[model samples]
Target: MNELATKHAALASRFQALAEAVQDWDAPTPVAEWKARDIVGHLTTWLPEMAAGYGIDLPKVTGDDPVQVWREHSANVQALLEDDAVTNRVVQTSAGDQTIAQVLDNFYLADIFMHQWDLAKASGQSVGWNPEVATSIVEGMTPMRDMLAESGQFGTPVVLDESHSPEERLAALIGRDPAWTAG
Candidate 1:
């Protein structure tokens, strides 16, 4: 497995685990109006649709079972990471045409990493976070805060104390209430 594959496995394992542990698919997440299942749905839906433009035929999620939805998606993404022929294919982006692997590293994997907390919180579980990655995410995104908000991908920033961990700060930056818990 490559670096992207390894990272995806590590991050996606947490996501899949949370999906399995979910006591309520309908449990609300910090992202208002989203249920635990929506986290899985979002991850599963977007990437396949996005990758289709690059000619990589990944599996589209078919069922509402969050665990199964995540499992299928994760497996296919991992396969893509390991497939040199597919990963090397170029796709156009703001950064110019880059390989599928690069795009995955920059976007899909990061998204999965960030959403781990959302799914975990909704499922009443805890997820491990890498402060380094969290810091990088915050730093990289802070400059694009306005564009991100305008795109409606993130919400108004949630304030946190200086003592908050990088992961908590990341959650807040991405529009999740760091202190939010499942009801």
Candidate 2:
């Protein structure tokens, strides 16, 4: 697998493990309104949508099974990474057409990091987000935050802790409380 694919697989595995754990856990998590199920559902929903934005049409499921969606989307992402036609190609978006590399390097990483936190919050699990990956994702996404800000895709900016983990910084960068609570 290429670098992007490798990162994606690592992230997926982490999430899958968390999903499994949450299935058995009865303890309350901070994101009370959206338990572990919702976090998985969100990843299942958005990951593919993001992949689809890259010009690959993942398998469409009849209902809202985020797991199935994630699986399908992940396949597409993998395919896109391997395909020559898409490797250097640019997919059009509201932000404009970005290269596949850019999508993988910048957007995909950020999405995974944020969703990892989302999953952690819902599942009441701690994330082991790599500081290097987190830093790279933040650097890649920082330029576009201004554009996303006007569209309200990113949250209000706040002072951040430099020593914070990548997931925490990433969550704060996008305006989500890394320590968000349902209550």
- Among the numbered candidates, top lDDT falls to 1
What is the Cα root-mean-square deviation between model 2 and the actual structure?
3.9
- For candidate 2, write residues 19-105 as lDDT tens digits: 655543333444444555555555456655766765566554334555555556566666666665666787776658777767675
Off by over 4 Å in 2: 24-35, 46-55, 62-69, 92-97, 139-148, 163-166, 181-183
lDDT of 1 by residue, 9-44 (tens): 988887777778889888899888798888888899
Q: What 10-residue stretch in candidate 2 is worst by lDDT?
A: 23-32
Count of residue pairs whose backbone atoms collide, per candidate: 0, 0
Give the backbone clash total of model 2. Answer: 0
**Candidate 1: residue 79 lDDT (0-100):** 86
lDDT of each: 0.83, 0.63
Model 2 error, position 1 (Å):
2.7
Estimate the lDDT of model 1.
0.83
